[model samples]
Target: MSKMDKKRMKYAAKPGLMAALDIGSSKIACLIAQPFEDGTIEVVGVGHQVSKGMRSGNIVDMTALELGVSATIEAAEQLAKENVRDVVLCTAGGAPESKLIAFDVAIAGHEIGDGDLRRALDPTWLYARQNEDRRIIQTLPVGFSINGTPVRDPRRLYGEKLGVNMHVITQASSAVRNLESCAARCQLDIESHVVAPYAAGLATLVEDEKNLGCICIDMGGGTTSIAVFKEGEVIYTAVIPLGGNHVTNDIARGLSTPVSHAERMKTLYGGCFVTGSDSHETIKVPLIGEDDSEENQVPRATLADIIRSRIDEIFEMIAQNIKDSGVDPNIGRVVLTGGASQLAGVRRCAADILARQVRRGRPAALRGLPEAATGPSFSAAVGLLHYALAERQQTSFTSLYSKEMPSSRFGRIGQWLRDNI
Candidate 1:
């Protein structure tokens, strides 16, 4: 009978196909899934392509990005034997920002209810409204308290005051618009936007890790993203502009090799730490703009040194970010995932630099996912599917002001109050 109830019914009536699209600087990936009656989804299609016209997760060339999106989606559709018009997009660009906001509402000694919860969250909505130049990606209720005492659920509790702590994540509006435009050009509609690191965390983190507190670091091609989870919710997030591509660039410059060759070399022979065998092994690096005969022979130790310096720098930056966030340094563990995390010794390097238990994380195994796509690089893409499922089931709070809300600011606020209050 209520607006939210009607919306739920509408979605329930049409549990159609769902898709997740992850557009990164190095690659664009698409996954198509079919939901079942038992509240589970199975992957039916998977596709990915080398990305172009993207830098640090933002679109640089609309046309080129459009082509990549179209191609990736088409490939997935072909595999799925189904056409999809809407996709949950996973984004790491747009200068994502995260902050915790606390708010309280006077309950007048009455039993708390949904109305009280909404009223307590009014400050968060107001905060979102004030930032016209940014779009909210997620607004999560991290904790609740009644009369200044921490409580899990304040509903039905007798309290004069109800308080809530919310974790809000936002991104620049221009970046969101560009991504939307690119999707539109590819004849695709964005059903929702999930932050990359958050998505990765959802897919790769175990329930214990989330509830007990842990950090999920997604090192992608152009950027590295961090998400801190506590009590089964994200408490903080940060993005660093350095990633695997930076290491590749370093290798290319240090070895005087082409970017493509440098990447291949890194993938095949690079490591963050030198080994005793490194000095004895040799790798032939082809000189840029030169014949194969002019290739330079270098000790594997030299290549490892180049990679070690950059990877160390990346981990150091991550360490500094965690410290700057003011989060507990002893927080349970650190899970590292992404393309860069696949490098040999990356886990060890991360442990050494972050001084925490570090493990390479990959997306949880899906029914139809290929083994090749089960690596850390696909965590964000798979996590988008998890986000879609959570949103559909209403198990997670996607946002206070969702896409289905009224268009006008005043109208939206009024409708929200009327619905909840």
Candidate 2:
């Protein structure tokens, strides 16, 4: 074989199956990825189940939660026809908390390189990581100033002192409990747990949006999560415990229908921003234990208004979060995603409420993705891979073995050491 062919083979050695689990309030999705010999990712397994035992992103019942997780995993395993070992999960619990902490350190008169910045921030991370009842999922660098000038990388620049603004997204203890117990029951291992908004942003937001300024709002079944990025750094994040489920409940109660039927009507006919002439048409919604012909006919505009009311409340809450974080001053655009985001007019409604330029956001991008994942709904699952790849790249660049699984799986030597030593 030629040298290039041999090099390609060497790179293909570590290509293994990576799975994504999006356990939301409304649904649970499992997507397993396999890297082909030609370096393409093929979706070998897919499983999705209606979520249960979760309330607004928190696990309220463990027994039901375990059964649900196991069932989903079993289906995915059956589809993949393999017993997968590791999976990455998404958590919107308690709305992953975001706090900005700044640290100023003297560089001892040395020019700051990537190593220098890392050295200076190591203690800051230790401080944040220590003495907390929470788990830190993402420690994103919002920005840095060397001396008096702002810098993006801030590495290899001369400076007497380096100051950094870091945003830490944290998960609550209950989140850990629900995910851990459920995964244990399912006999699956969680490689990492990431904030839903952050992961979703990774899948949907473009590089320019991150580098410039953009906000990612993930409207899921249980909660609405917001992550703000400036210059490609997440500056703020917050979770609101209201999602599409609330809308379904409202419809169920307001229209006197079952929750299941209400959900069906919502997905098939839900809209946040109603247009003119909505009253000219009517939709047939089945009541509890009723035939189709006996269904209730209601103005489509009324349903849109109901969906909008709850969605408005959710957006108003998120707006306050961004303002409170002092991130809106820098944000220039917005991206919306999640299961609830699939609703008609959601993008438009969000834009009107936030009063900013808005667009539907999907998962940002992946190395080897296909058309199956093109929808806006798959943002979180696709983003998990991006987050892992970014983390891997950072670690691998810092290590002596720069080429060993820098963007995906680690080499055997590294994995062995991580597991054993």
Candidate 3:
């Protein structure tokens, strides 16, 4: 059967709510959305809580992570007044790697159809499968060149050789298994897994920026990741094990304050650039366990200095990674997302360090998205919604296929326990 025919036969018209869960090092967030006929996702519910049991995107404490996940899901369900059995999850913990694989298949002057496309894609899947220790999460067709001519839709065209460029994103197997285990413990099924930076780029980037080439930097609590986009598809990604929490830690250590107080000071008085009055501006910092006292005062300029040093270091690291990855020099713009991007003066710092145009990107406003949720921090969650919408509109040829896995007896035993218990 033709691929389109098979797709139609396999799935029926059962449109319903789409749930997206973003499990990050700093927070656990869930967004419940319903796609309309017009291709827009109306967010019906949103929930987020302070992250626990996860460190640097890895689950350090399973029970603690499960409790956080459950609480976040319950809040979202309460807001939506509906429950979800499955969710599209966003992950940053898996040491994700992106590769562009170029392959060609001989079409023998025949009309391009499902068979031709499938043949072209088979090798890409094979390459992903060869990496036994990795879990393939995203397989995106970057573009197609038919007999040296570029075309977006190659079906029905006649060519001797059809060449395809596919961008494959893979993550560590252990990270994925841990996330899946956490969801299973909560009685939730994972519909699909998306890389965090990829989702953020999808939610916030415009078509023009993507086509023209751009970099998306997602600064979470425990990790800062980058996604490079060219021709409207992600071509490269890298992550650093440092983020806003590190800066907070530095402040806590430097200023002899508590972590919680350091976070508060970072949010309120944090800036990469210092003004003349900063030296004279004294901010009251309360001790973690002590009451308000006169000795707990520090100059705001000192705080800015600490923040600027760390932020500058982050940008320098990002620039070096981009250079090392050999990202296209034509990528002249950098879009910064995630909670850390909200800090004052980050844009200018990134621009000066990365030597690119920098702008803070927030999730695109959609129906029922409150003003509070329309910030850079929520970009990944919102991008999950956008991914679902794009998936819904995809033709059979463009759909992402999950990697093949052998059914394990241990998996069956675990399933039986969950079902029976």
- Poorest stretch of ten by lDDT in candidate 1: 412-421
Q: Indicate the worst ten consecutive residues by lDDT in candidate 3.
A: 412-421
> Which portions of model 3 miss their true places by more than 4 Å?
1-15, 123-128, 287-291, 395-397, 400-421
Q: For all candidates, what are the clash counts?
A: 0, 8, 0
Better of 2 and 3 by TM-score: 3
Candidate 2 per-residue lDDT, tens place, 154-193, comes to 7777778788776655566446655766776566667666
What are the lDDT figures for the candidates, one per model? 0.81, 0.70, 0.79
Pairs with backbone N, CA or C atoms under 3 Å apart (clashes), candidate 2: 112-156, 113-156, 203-363, 203-364, 204-362, 204-363, 204-364, 210-232
Q: Indicate which candidate wins on TM-score.
A: 1
lDDT of 1: 0.81
Tens-digit lDDT track of model 3 for 216-309 = 9999998899999887878888888789999999989888888998999899888887788676898877766666673477888889999999
lDDT score at residue 296, model 2, on the 0-100 scale = 89
